[model samples]
Target: MDMWSYFYTCLVSVWLHRLYVYSAVAFGISLWIVIQFTTTRTKRKGKKSHRNPSSPEGTSDKVGNGCAPRQAQEVHVAGVKIFYGSQTGTAKRFAKALAEAVTSLNLPVEVINMGDYDPEDGLAEETSSRNICVFLVATYTEGQPPESAAWFCKWLEEAANDFRVGKSFLQGLRYAVFGLGNSAYVDHYNTAEELFETSSEEEAGGTDSVVDVEDLGNIMGNMKKAKREQELQEGAAGAERREMITPALREALTKQGYKLIGSHSGVKLCRWTKSMLRGRGGCYKHTFYGIESHRCMEATPSLACANKCVFCWRHHTNPVGTEWRWKMDQPELILQEALEKHQNMIRQFKGVSGVKAARLEEALAVKHCALSLVGEPIMYPHINSFVRLLHQHGISTFLVTNAQFPEEIRRLEPVTQLYVSVDASTKESLRRIDRPLFKDFWQRFLDSLKALAEKQQRTVYRLTLVKAWNVDELKAYADLISLGKPDFIEVKGVTYCGESSASSLTMANVPWHGEVVSFVRELARLLPDYGIACEHEHSNCLLLAHSKFQVDGEWRTWIDYGRFQELVREHQRSGGSRTFTAADYTARTPPWALFGARERGFDPLDVRFQRKNKARDISGC
Candidate 1:
């Protein structure tokens, strides 16, 4: 060909080849798109979606394993309700079907219409009822609850934000949110704030949509943990009849200022708690650890204690046992009951003379939980879960054990502070005073101290010194104190409750404030890395803190509660990968709260009331 003709011919051939290649590529793309469409359509045609989307680990905490079924347990559900809020009738239908399935499982469930329900009036009641309230809500155009459920959403957000309603107003209520709509508004299904998180174990009309009972068991009602415990205790004898607090015992506890929760847990306002509410004084904990006593809830999950100590403030009328053979209550239920009960008791003081409205408002929202009331709190199987519940509510945990459950202490989750009751220094002394049920109590006590030594968080050696019973064993206590290397040592006079069949302890057994001080002074000399830290004069309580808390001559005995909360939340966010020590959240001890202050560790802002009676006077009222 000629040069120009050859070039044009070559260019035309190249253009034709390029066009062919582009056509083939476009054809392949079209074919692939059609194949994908066909496959996706086929997959979507008849297949049902059973699985609820799970936010991966660290996004949010999910409690249950829904992939498998769990065995049933002895614990019975107190209340069951299937709540629905639907624009159409779809969510209501789902609720009815789920309720029917639950009924098939021999569980009686009430179907609720959220539209007619006043959450502010009825929601708080549900918490006290300890019920499993399931929400079946359908999303409308946006990520919002239907008009029927608008009141609930508003109430819930208010419960969280509005201080008047209290931050944890609906705490301890076990409820799951299920979205009736498809995945378009998955993020804002069921409730206004809480995401649609749970699935059903019992299918709705045998569709693919189902939530595993195991997952429901943990987050909903704790059936799985109970079932696991039941399986472990298969051949145990007569667990049903052995309620922790019998009806008669409940009457006694009620009379003694205690409100019983579930079958086992109990909450009572501490005298110190009452005092702080009236602008009187806080407890020794406030002096040593900077805990706000008025806002502290004193509760115990297991009211069946291990000891019938002579000095028990309630005259040791509580049930006594070693292992938890009684019907176990769920931790979430216990938490709910505790908060409500404590708040109700505080509410009773609303019109009382000295109760400041501000303190009353503050006390309604619990800040600290003292698991030191009338029982072995750590003995509860689900103590860790209970602690988590408290922490999740922005409440700090101060769990006190009678040094009887070493393995339990080892297995316990992190707390703001862990206290082991060194009721007596010597083995013989412990046996005489604590009157422990466990035969290997002495070994358990020693092992408990060792476990406390291993804990990353703050550990305390709590000594309830009875003048004639345990005070003379200073050398022995010194040796044990060296072994534990605890962060703080609390020495307080034993509370002398009236005549008890349990023991012959009298007012004579209780030490004077001077005697306690002298004893603490002598004990302090023998111990190293420990010195007198703080004291609550009215409480007759002396605190000895570790040398580490003393930085450049300033005592860091008090806790920065907000910092502690932040650290714990972050630790949980990190999935427990990160560890925090006691020093991390320590705050500087205020001068007035120190041992040698004029007010003697009592907050200066409080008004002192002098009572005439011996019990009231000596007890620092």
Candidate 2:
């Protein structure tokens, strides 16, 4: 093999292992070769030593056996550094995937385990280079930092104090953190909340009782101040609000132990109201959007999920409770209210347009990117009608469903992109991971996958790879995928969180992105018909499969929005409620009658990055 191909294969192999130590070794070796081969002669100007493939000043001398060469030192500029402090492995797995997403930018990145470094010595103090720090820290028992994070916490605190006390430690330091913990944990829950709350306690105190009359006289001014105060308050409260607990829930959770951790009310997105506006809401390093543009969309309009997956990062009641059917809204009303609130949020941020003025307006206007928000949005009974309403407004919809509801999938019109989360390959593992609502959920999921294959709209089969539970089913999963024949198959690692924490699910059980990638690629190799499509190296997600849709006579894969809208509209009219049957679920959507997928002109990367432009951010109860 040629040098580049050989190096790429080696790098891919090392990354696929999912063991950080091994990956680091491979990274170091590859860096040395690249630096040796790519270095060129250079001249020094003044005192600054101009060395070919020169290291970033002090960084060159700060060496270790695992050191990367000067060219390798530039990894940070291209890729994000993901430092995960995890007890079992959830944070690490999530961090890996996040890093993959960051790498998808085509920038190289180095993913390191917090456990591998000696905090005081390992973490770089000063460097003439820019590196984005993405930390995924998970807290453990009694609301304490996880065991693996012990050194990281001590070192981080010591480093902070050292910088402040001696006045010279954090020179080039810049970072972001994602705290993985349950609100149910009484004390340290939402511990990362402090990462964003910058204002003083005094400001919070004053905002508590600002009279309504003060708001009327200076509407904009008072509202802005109030919003800022509330944002800070929410920041603090978000940091402090432990998930509400009751005796029964606690008892049930205690029995499940680690599995219970998977039961957290997934990080609820910040809600927006006229009361929470702040001057061009500055992005917080720890906020959801700051981590992934995928998280940037302003609202999760609905929160009704269908299947209660075993490893979901959602509370038990969120899936099983009987109270949900009571609170609901019409699709039209929700779109109107959500958009109006989003627009108002954008207006509030217009004050700080600053250098980002060119794209500020587009960012703030909430274009609907609705993921069946939480609960089984498809189960709404009027799901077909709802999707039609979304399409009418040119909104993009992402419907995530547990395969349990093939009946619903069949009845509804084709959505923007339909996602079927496949957690297990066989009935046994399926039951263990997804304690189904019905005894036949396994069969239903299989049936759903088969049905999804026939839908004319874009389809993506998602497999959440959990380490201990179903990692052994790689071959079986491939067989299942072959049976379904999806257009795109995405493999992602299961985060060690939510209700699963109450059971055996722990950070230790979380597999890194590379491990996931390796598994998926192997499956891809086995199923030669499928090709590796897109990959988010940092996020540890791999998209594989054949492109079935024809875009301007070119075979490709992506949602055909125009055609999707037509089908939704058609279903709304001709295929009335009475016409729906099990056969309708697999009914072929004729793409010939529908319009083609339009070339969106703009880069999706840009859209993903600049999307957070503003509006009321609401969380469905």
Candidate 3:
């Protein structure tokens, strides 16, 4: 019985042991599964938290169901700021185009209107090394800033008003400017750009001001001494005249291929003069206004001016003054010297090929004088006397002025042809383009135009058109024309002669002859009384004349030279009481000289025209 009981106990014990092993193994396997599951869940929850957009950098520390704190991040900005002052949306469009263009460079650009931008708003603190500002602005009316940019301009003009910013506040600011303006309004054409540079100068206390007259005299004297020394070196020593002029100015004039006339005068042979020497005919003026090109003397009694015009081909090399300060040369002496120098200049072309002997002889006679070589010819105090002298010598005078001196124009003696450059239709444009010395230059310009309207002689308004600048101001131009009431308008394209320091003109600013014609056609549509009278293709110039000049469909734009001389003599005899009118000395214009004529002033006998006609005839046959 004991053996049987022991066997049962052993069996039960063995069963119990097997049950313990199975249970332990199962518990271990389950425990391992739970651990693995917990680890996997924790990793997945960490990844989900990292990917949460709300967490930003994904460093979310949870402490019992609440998110812990995170450190702040720094932001960096990299690119340019473009500010624009637009009058007609052009500048804004350009700014946008620039912004889009810079995007490819991985540059961040922000464009703001001048009206909305403030220099005090962190822009003033920006250094050129890291930030750049571009200004694309347009000049508004009467040499003033656009309404949108008035605040900025006013701020620049009154730098002392800003206590927070020093005078050199803009020194650290790097900027580029693109000015939209017309060359016609000489005073206001590029006011925006001028103001930008001038503001900087004003901050540096370098703004332009009236120079003392004695200093000019000193400069003139120095120039004379230099010339005398130069002449001595060249073995052409003459009497030493005591005068003073800027040495730098004299050097600049010499470098620009100018022949100095006396102390403050200069003469330059025109391209037309060279062309006439080559027998290629004269300037369009010869065709339109009866000017004898070969006999025309291009000179200026005064090489100093009150304004620095952007389109001036002389490149601002000439001296600038508000009034004549240098020693004055007598008109009689100037005439004698001018004629002698002019003849001497003509003598050089005598032996050149294509120069006609008779034409060269005519050139020596000096029948006409164009006071447009450079500077303001009328600025010469002896201008009236000079004109009289030219008339006495049977030389027709054509005087050109920038119209900055109204009183001078009012008191001036009549010339055969008088030209007042109507550069800008608006006052703002005139200030910008002309850069006039007079602070009241706009009022002076208007008074000058009014003065021109009262003239009895042949008066002309010279309009030099620059593409995309003054080309769109047709109505404003017509308004100015009404004020002047000029007998003729000479619309000529701006001549882009390489680059100039005085102007930011490019070849792109030059318009084609066709464009000039189109512009004239549009202008003529507005002025029914004025007709497209003539055009010079080579010069890209057009002439508009009042209908009164078209007596019975025959253009009377030509000046009767002999009649004019007789009238001038009569006026001189009558003590200048019987002033001559343009109609009194008018002559008939040839049929071919008309703008739309088939011949169009090209000599009908020319071989080129004959060949063209013959070809057309053959084709018609």
Best by TM-score: 3
Local accuracy by lDDT, each model: 0.77, 0.52, 0.76
Query: In order, what is each prediction's RMSD in angstroms?
Result: 25.1, 31.5, 22.3
Compute the lDDT for candidate 3: 0.76
Better of 1 and 2 by TM-score: 1
lDDT of 2 at 283: 21
RMSD (CA, angstroms), candidate 2: 31.5
The digit string of per-residue lDDT tens for model 1 on 384-461 reads 888998999999999998888889999998999999988998877876677666767789888989999999999999
Candidate 1: which stretches are off by over 4 Å?
1-241, 612-621
Which of candidates 1 and 3 reaches a greater lDDT?
1
lDDT of 1 at 370: 90
- In the range 1-621, model 3's lDDT, one tens digit per residue, is 999999999998988799888989999999999999999999977876555222333432222211222222111224668888876576789999988965654567889898987765655566444445677777865666676778887777677346555666666454556677644455566777678656755453342321111232234346568976775665455445435347878888878777776788777677777777656656788879878787888999999888877688887777776766567788888888888887888899978877778888878898888999989999998899989999999999889999999899999987999999987788777766777777788898989999999999999999999887788889999988889999999999999877753366799989988899999999999888899998766678889999889998789999998899999999989988888799999998876667877655543322221244355321101
Where model 2 places Cα greater than 4 Å from the true spot, the runs are 1-302, 317-328, 342-355, 496-504, 547-555, 559-621
Can you give the TM-score per candidate against the true fold?
Answer: 0.61, 0.45, 0.63
lDDT of 2 by residue, 1-621 (tens): 599999999889877876987778899999998876665422223324443222333332322232445344322242356777776577878988877766665655777887786656644541223555566777654344666667767655554445343433333444555667643233445453233111111212323321111112134335457866876787677644323234465464445421121122111223221112222222211011111222223334334354455566644535342113333456666556655654554565556524244344454543335453355555555566656766777665667777877776776676656788888898888876875655456678888888887776557778888888888887888888877777667777876664343344678777886798678768877777776544443344556746343334433443344454555566667754423222222222222211121211111222212236554322100
